[model samples]
Target chain A: MIERIESFRRRRPRLLEERVTLAHGAGGKASAALVDAVFVEAFRNPLLEPLCDGAVIDLPGGERLVISTDSFVVQPRTFPGGSIGQLAVHGTANDLAVSGAVPQWISAAFVLEEGFPIAELKQIAADMAAAAAETGVQIVTGDTKVVPKGAADGVFVTTTGVGVIPAGRDLSARSVRPGDKVLLSGSMGDHGMAVMLARGDLAIEADIRSDTASVSPLVESLLAAAPSTRWLRDATRGGVGTVCNELAQACGLGVLLDEEKLPVRPMVAGACELLGIDPLYVANEGKIVAVVAAEETEAAIAALRSHPLGADAAEVGEILEEPAQTVVVRTGFGGTRIVDMLVGDPLPRIC
Target chain B: MIERIESFRRRRPRLLEERVTLAHGAGGKASAALVDAVFVEAFRNPLLEPLCDGAVIDLPGGERLVISTDSFVVQPRTFPGGSIGQLAVHGTANDLAVSGAVPQWISAAFVLEEGFPIAELKQIAADMAAAAAETGVQIVTGDTKVVPKGAADGVFVTTTGVGVIPAGRDLSARSVRPGDKVLLSGSMGDHGMAVMLARGDLAIEADIRSDTASVSPLVESLLAAAPSTRWLRDATRGGVGTVCNELAQACGLGVLLDEEKLPVRPMVAGACELLGIDPLYVANEGKIVAVVAAEETEAAIAALRSHPLGADAAEVGEILEEPAQTVVVRTGFGGTRIVDMLVGDPLPRIC
Candidate 1:
């Protein structure tokens, strides 16, 4: 690793222009490039080679451990239906869950600004505790650091989770096949729309609530029903469209999403329309995109729908052999258009 | 856990003032109270009951896992001899190492402010990679988030580490006995003073460099020489004084430190005198406090001195049976003074 890092340092290829932009955090091309150039290049390792949502480690005891992390810098700390605390817990738990790991322990670290409200902090803690209990995970350890007022936004929470993946359950984007069926575990754009509305940045208002709930239970049901699931990922920062693109690229396959079949709440859809944002590119906290064998699609959907968080689950897409490494959305008007990752963040700090 | 949280909420004792003050994060009385009221009261679990530097879990295969997390919000991203990235890695690794765990995997989550320099980010990542390699730990998985320029100070790195504790090697503050010897790995105040100089906050300037190096090797040496080592901790955010307080409270014992035995660099001592700050309260990223049986004190110090990071290691304090849960410092002028925890953060975001 030292030799690899030294080799890169010797080249010193000007990786970025000068300053980091919002696009760098948009979970798009820019984000990928930043990660590859700065992090992956420096800390190259087999566990991180897959570039999956989480890293899988094999313990000496023949147990597989999956670890994932996320930092929540959502605006308005408290949003409709949930707060940053809930998002922090659910985000990492979902990441591990989607990786075929049974979420177990989580560590939360908070960077708080001085003069923040103690009452609000307590409320956030309560939200985190409730989310952990509901997901059957324990918040085992934590750290808190306070910065002077103005040095940081109200509060930012980073949660890192560890879970155990049962033997024989190997979930990865590389397992995706050309004939795989794509499953959407619930509606799109709910989390982003809800946060945007709560921020009141736009004059438009809607009765939208974030689908901020843990997807672990839903994942358990899906895995039990469709043991041949190829890949799984939560539609987070860059949303379902971005996830499809990542999956397609990872497997060198094409994805075709039927626009008419995409699950989206009416309120979220209306807000996306008003904001001129594609629902497919808006984040959803309590949603997932699963790729399963074509033969198991029905069972997967059935299992997902059996869970409250996935009641709106649907088979929205399928993998195609042609147009490799791309995502095309079939329009309601019988037309098709390529769906690319967002170039820049439409709603900064939405989650 | 749910019932406990509900019971606390029902009381509504107004545990804290409306707003969070710097004291709440000083790792002192206020910080303890805040954690007890907000986090401990909510996420009550067996693993978290000890409230030690890290949480220990028993893996199914008879292996014990220690997990710890810390967020680096240092004022200056780059300080003399080290950077926030190095601190992030060493900080978490030391937490696990002191817990008698062989540091293994670490996950880092970064929160960057928009418009931050990409070159600086690259340097930080490189620093982290070097630190990880030096510490024999792998950077497995990570996440990155960006906030608008003013929303965050610059960059805050949160690292969560996981390690495996060898069989029958239990290290905890609760294990400290009345006849224990407290050994200091090296000098104090170097890290805090170096960061202060980097920030250019005060008119006084000192030629001090942070002792920001991994302490795992030193810990290995000590453990080998003195298998009876009872407790270990890195003197970090709140410094050795704060750690002493916590250790005393956790074990229901008193700690006595000889002022003459305390090691401090000439530059740091001069700076501390100018600023009217006690060196004991200054943070040390690369130093550690090991509590070993009185009979093993000589061997522990000898072993520590064999390592580069612990060249200046010395037995500076001892555990006492009387004055349980208190810390006293013997003055060079033939007097003793209570070394109470700081009421407020003298150096906020010092990491």
Candidate 2:
């Protein structure tokens, strides 16, 4: 019997058992089956199945787009406030959103270390699906690769997202100029402190939780309200300090932040003090820093302060043409210290 | 001192102490310093120096493109034939190429396991730079995070590549049809087998080296010769078997391969016999499986044969509409066996 492409798919590979391991994540066999059995089955579409390297997405109303990729390797796999799965979704989506893109689709690639818990894998998949639903982006495509037990941490996730930005709404750090106002969506240090608490760093016992969640909606609101918004950045890897330093450098302007105005929860501050960590340099998963033109700053603040995700929004800083390309923190005592990107890994405690 | 965006240089973070540790890769302070000292310093440019969340690249020729992301977490980070560094470049580039795109620029993100040798990282970085340069792509942007020792293996690398395919190049498994010819470029299983050999699994070692090289040039040649080529798949992950099966399913056709025509190296085949692994399922980093129309099969083969990378290329199979979506292998003895994607991890090896 001379068979062709279609004939063989009739005898598609079956999931060997109900347990998950690193190999299943290896972007190979197990990964394919996992996607077939879970993600593809959940999100059915022609674009999802060709399993093309990445989703060749078509933007609604027609416009060229924005794309981003991120990998999540959170230790403890399951965290106090969220799982690695949830973090993967929000973390990547936010990356796209802050870039001023309407987050649409994401490609999730998982690297499962050998012998990982199967239930954990399914749970992660479920979380991924749910997060996708919330973000209005589907897990359009993925790859799995399995390495030997010693090759990886329990699991690492790499996601690439594609989003469309409507024309005429420019969002880049270079757009910031003198008199632009910096707006923070919510409290800082909660996510970092929560991780320390999860690690049981000390008896100080922080009740603060990771603020990880989808921010596309918040970003959408801001972009709509502040059409003149110059830049948007989420405080993630290198936290606020790193992002601000980047912004200043990108715009050739100085970013002056009033330290007392930053929204830091009491418990997070206590944890940071006890741990000797600078909250400014530590990672934050759920917050964003937006630089809006001075004219729209008030309306933008009002719009953000009314949203659930940004009710604690604060006007923490301003862009100045003087002292260009530096982040200067105005101390509570009226003095200023140069705030720079944490050049090295700031908190060696977490991945 | 104040500096213009053009004049501004990223500052080095204050040191905790001498000597890098696992904690440095933890997405904290140390990770930042490592990025500033090494990667940022090495690949400084206007587009990269800002260290934004993701690079806003100018897609050449204004074509809608394909973007793929991959993270390399192979154990032994460095192996006899290659290191995770080169693997990162190859893996991401191949992902884009197989999707029928001209692999272009890449962004690399490293999660360095703390206390790992700096020299090792330097080597990986050099390999990455060399690989990108050779492939006509630039490592336009990158990020580094360090995690303390116990929390990591040696190191893990994540690379995201974006490539542009000419409009109307409808290449996909779904396009394979009856009367199509399936071709294999060079030998199979060298890459995976090399991994096994590197691990010292067998007493009878084959001189078989890892077929770890870029397949984009080969793909370019095949497309140029047979512009109507149906599908081009790198037989990675689940190897040739899975690729055939994928084509079969996508085209709603069956594919039958003549076993004798497959270019399996004798030594690699012998080693597989001793190890009980199917060469069909072992990963092939460098080889590609292409299915093309009946009319230009010889021209496709001729084009492949001309390239050193595709010297051993051969037409191994034919596609038929009957018995849709199945893969059948005609044995040397005139019998046939179904070749399907593996149900689980084949060897649980890293990419």
Candidate 3:
């Protein structure tokens, strides 16, 4: 390996601006060059220097902070609709958003399962940089670790984000009340279904795609309009059922869902039915479930509908006082059954 | 999968506490039970209950904070001197120590390559819990991700540590001065050589053991005595050569090492000679390189020698201004040659 690097140093090519290579993931000269030329060059800032393993940021205003870390193991490395790179940025931003914090900094750690193509890694890095810029967050620090071929499956990313919540903003599952209305931001189960369809037995491609996105700004606006928004959860792993169940556990209340009023795309619904999977147990990367005071339901829904990613927003259910700790879904056949928390992750590795 | 869990739930015996099976890493019922009955039972703390991806702790006093992350992927999983679990703890804690930080909370994430023996996993977890207790640092939160068989090599551990340093106690590479003395906390390259010997490559066994340990207390003592300590770096990946070269670059100074004065165990020396690798480039998990003011050189050495992990501490060399940014090793024959950083890692996956 040292001999190879020595040979490269002797050549010292002039085409400094090109796609990345495996050497970039190596913690050596080539890797340093890659960082200097691409990530740091594009996202020029004092914070990203001679980068530290992690960044030390002082809150602009002294307040309790929000911190989140997520790891993305999305297979295929790159897929239709979105790549793992974009998913990392959006996933982290959404974490901060739901916590009612305006995210300020992010740390990206890439674990490249060896044999992953360099061009693809570079593309992923570029996507991450662009996504960070778009979301108004700084990719302040990063660490790259490369495992030998076969030790890792493909490319896995672990991103850590820090955000600051404005003082006086109270958002928690504990704050949710029995009469609060549940508002879902956009179509459900698109993200997980898209990835599954992209990977497996789907003979025909569908219009449905992963609705992965950053919702910090959208969340801020909604919370601003409806300060009484009791609770918010990004419908991620285990989909709506998981978040609702956690909320139920948190608030000590039950939820009753009107299945006829729930929004599900035809393609997603059909795919779930064919796969013998319940859409409720699937995951969604961008959709969020907001439990708000009934008086502010309209304003919350309006805020969600205004965002492009939330156009299909709808009021699906409301918190209930009776049937403690159980979620009953009212079906179109005048029958009702429990909408329990997902037993386990059915659509595994959706993130 | 859900049925499997339900069956386990219905017929569950009193917490399968004795033998471990593959299900422990399966992210299912067994895994959750393992965490509950064992890890939680042993390391129970309120901060760990939330079970976020990692722990978020606010430093007690208002001072600059230090944070670091490391991954441990060792072959044979456990060896003569250390296990992957111990390495994970020492690797991350040392990162904090060398950075002039008083290590605090740590988050340990495990990625188990499938088919890892359950007994081995339990032992590894026990090793980690014990190590954390010894160091007085809490493993506040954790995550476990399981990959199918052949997806990972045994189990890989990634730990992130957060520490805090007093505001004025700055330790920087550039702080090294012309007359500064360099100190080693312990014997060099034992970790690498021990692992190499354990790899079953030699006609004769080398009685080497890994110097894997936490260097925080040692570093603190050294700093306390030599309050004007210029810099500190763990002699780990890429070893002494890489660290010296890095210091030269950052400090804009040259470092000259008297090869005769440098310390290396005879067993390790024989192994390095046999493998045609330089001991200077071999890794050390517990050892540290401290650059201290010449006036406090004796005090620093005494400080180091007091720590159990630093009984073999020695002053190896001194910082010099001639030919700034170069590392020269003085051979016994009165000849000198540049000791450059290993361009790429000499032993791939050595860590």
Candidate 4:
């Protein structure tokens, strides 16, 4: 772990930007740079050194705790199939779930614009309550603050979730081995496409709904079937491509994706094509990417397919021994292309 | 506990406004009404029924954990004595401290507006690191999101803190008895006045600084000296007056404050007078109001006085057996007046 931290420090690039841009929050290279250079350096500690979706801590009493925090700023507040309230709860809970923990409690804080509608706020709160109930977590504490009219958009929610990791259930990206297979749950780009269409900024339309649901159930089934799972992550923000890059960087290895095996809904693919965006780099809220031992690949796919949220789960990629710290895709056209972490924003505030 | 919950439900007023107002976030009557009517009712559960600053959970392992969340949206980002970064850490940590817990870990979520300066962000993060270090807490996990320029203020931070409750420590507002004495740690309104002055909206100026420091040390010393302490709360948001009102409402009793005994810095008092606001209803970050058994009043004051942050510790009030749910102040002019929870926005975004 010390060596990993040292390597991470060595790889961090110097930040030269004088001002923040949309790229800084795009969950791509700029976001990673900001977090690595500013936050990780300032709050350096062993518990945070992993740079995992959630921070894991071992209590003096032998209890393992996982905690994660996320702030939701999706545009329009209301989007197809979901609202910020539901997304906020699922977002934090999914982080814990991916870390091999069962989310138990959550704290929500809301920042509201002065003239925002109270009815909308109540509806958002209701959505949050419903999501918490379905996710089997309790909203135990919260805070609310209001800014002047122009100081904020309609509403923003920040949720922090606490979960407990079961014994013998240690999963991490660093555990990835040479022949690990990457399994993805469901299709890609549905969430980002739905939110973009909901904004009505584009003339083109599609029958897409944001796949914004808690992935805990799918995670539990997968882990139960494939006990040797190396790593798991919810493909949010910068989507599957970004998550793959992170996994490769953490393990000091490379990843190879078979484009023919990737899952994508027709509507999402069309929308991405029309917008000149790659579905692989779009955000996802309900989907997860899992790396499992090659021997357990069939069992992992079977377990995920049995879950309702993972009906489309498939083996999409494999971990590579060569070209350390890079991600390459084997295109259907019999060619290979390097897929790097997203550099600029094609769609902002999608999640 | 059921009866308390029932009473809370009975007293909650209907929310009639169609839109949220600045007063709704002023940490006063409107804020309480919105929380009770919207959040409490939606997220109703036993753990959140008490409406304490932090929620205390008893783990199956015989360990007690307390969690609290707060959002800081103070205007200007930087203020006299502290930046929003420092205030964010202190605010959440203080919540856990007042709940008789030792703050151990914190998670921060930042929402940054596009085009914000990177240097300012670095300074803010540094301030947060300093505050966390001073309070002996670790920032283990965090997330960041960026919004367009007009969508949000410069920076808004939401922090969630987790702490552990020591063995045999059970402090609660419901434990307040009629004869319990109230002890204040330090001066009131310093933080509020300082922030307001820093905004430069008023021509009147004074050498006042925000008292935005963690109150954990003061709480520890007071609890050590007064083992029978009933309740502890920081004077934030709606200030000491609102805290007293909440105590009276929670315990079904009355609070009697001696105006002359309340500690107020000369500058803060003068500024409040000029602004036509009462110091008792203004905010303070580093101050605490403690409810202790009558017999331990002197010991509690002595313990507080020994701490640098609590040098102005004094016995300012006592619990009353009559006039349930009322807070009255006995003025130096030999008259008594009801000190109701603030009704309007005398100070918005003061925290």
User: Could you say which candidate leads in lDDT?
Assistant: 4
- Model 4, position B106: C-alpha lDDT score: 93
What stretches of model 1 exceed 4 Å from their correct place?
Answer: A1-16, A45-53, B1-16, B45-53
Q: What are the runs in model 2 whose C-alpha is more than 4 Å off?
A: A1-65, A321-324, A343-346, A349-351, B1-64, B75-81, B321-324, B343-346
lDDT string for model 2 (A98-155, tens) is: 8777786666666666555545665777777667777886554444554555656677
Runs of candidate 3 exceeding 4 Å displacement: A1-63, B1-63
TM-score of chain B of each: 0.93, 0.81, 0.81, 0.96
Clash count list over all predictions = 0, 65, 0, 0
- Writing each residue's lDDT as its tens digit, candidate 2 over B229-285 gives 987778876678866765665566788999999888998999889888888878888
Docking class of 1: medium
- Candidate models: Cα lDDT each: 0.84, 0.67, 0.68, 0.87
Output the TM-score of candidate 2.
0.78
Best by TM-score: 4
Name the docking class for model 3.
incorrect
**What's the distance in Å from true for residue A10, model 3?**
63
Candidate 4 Cα outliers beyond 4 Å, as residue runs: A1-10, A45-53, B1-10, B45-54
Accuracy of chain B in candidate 2 (TM-score): 0.81
Ranking by TM-score: 4, 1, 3, 2
State the DockQ of every prediction: 0.54, 0.06, 0.04, 0.60
TM-score winner between 1 and 4, please give it.
4
- Predicted complex 2: CAPRI docking category: incorrect
Fraction of native Cα-Cα interface contacts (under 8 Å, chains A and B) also present in model 3: 0.06
Better of 2 and 3 by DockQ: 2
